[model samples]
Target: MKLTLTPSTIHPPFGRYAHGVKATGSGILVASGQLGIGPDGTVPADAEAQARICMDSIVAILREGGLTLGDVVRLNAFVTHHDYFAPYMAVRDEYLADLRQKPASTLVVAAGLSRPEFLVEIEATAVF
Candidate 1:
């Protein structure tokens, strides 16, 4: 897959992330932004829990897309606070541990998201 990263109109871009991303390919999967929908039948409503669940959801989508984590070519993480970085990153590493190929990534911090219960949101690009 081919991808393009764009700047966020609200927050100026720094070294960390692009404001947006665009992609085009022969055949591609635009995985929906996965929420931390857990077994309890409700979203955990915690930042770290949600982030981990989000990544898990991403993994599921990867499989559904006929790809694996190693196929991920780019990643974008959205969070409300930088303080959550360590724990969130730990969960990310746990899932991406054996990724044969690592994707380029960016983490975004915002004042708020679509929902207050959501602590983090993730969007990604994968080439398979």
Candidate 2:
């Protein structure tokens, strides 16, 4: 089972995410951070497109483990610049919209990623 936590004592999350998530299940799966590169080895120039690719990779990883987005308990995302924040969040929110209990999430603006062309990276932790 999973429980979303947003206690009245603290401010609500600014986005589509819970302040924390309490999960109890058989095991936890932590996916590595995924870059914006696609299977064709192409990286989109647009931040929103890159963000979508990152989220898609995360979804594929979760599905491989027999889990869905709803099973996700946490998310950590990194963007190359402050300008990319909104675009990244927009893509992320679209992916997580249907979940009953949103996962705890964090978004960071980094100086750069492994590759200069890469604009975003996303990782997830899921319980199953």
Candidate 3:
């Protein structure tokens, strides 16, 4: 089982995510950061579209480990600029909307990603 924690001592999360998640299980899966580039080597120009692709890639990685989004406990996301935060969060919220317990999440604006064309990158940790 997993528990989402938000201590009253601290300010509430600014987005649709928990401050922390406690998972008690035997296995833990950590997926590498996924870039916005598609399998065909195409990168979308829109930040929202790139964010969606990043989330989709993370979903596929979780599935490969025989787990679903429900098993995810944490997510770390990076964007090339502050302007991309809203678009990235929109996509993240959409994909995780159905989850009963939101995962712990962090989004950072970095100077750049591995690729110049990539706008967003996402990584996930799951417990099962």
Residue pairs with colliding backbones in model 3 are: none
Q: Candidates' TM-scores?
A: 0.72, 0.79, 0.79
How do these models rank on lDDT, best leading?
2, 3, 1
Which regions of candidate 2 fall more than 4 Å away from where they truly are? 1-26
Q: List the residue pairs that clash in candidate 1.
A: 8-19
Estimate the lDDT of model 1. Answer: 0.64
The Cα error of candidate 3 at residue 91, in Å, is 0.2
lDDT of each: 0.64, 0.77, 0.77
For residues 1-128, write the lDDT of model 1, one tens digit per residue: 43433312122332454323334455454444555556454667567788887787666666655667787777788788888677678788887888776778888888977667667777766764
RMSD of 3: 11.5
Taking every candidate in turn, the Cα RMSD to the unseen true structure, in Å, is 9.0, 11.5, 11.5
User: So what's the TM-score on candidate 3?
Assistant: 0.79
Range of the 10 consecutive residues with the lowest summed lDDT in candidate 2 = 5-14
Question: Per-residue lDDT for 1-128 in model 2, tens only?
Answer: 65554444322334576534445464776666777877767788999999887787667666655678998899999998999999999999999998889999999999998789989988888887
Model 1 lDDT at residue 89: 80
Clash statistics: count for each candidate: 1, 0, 0
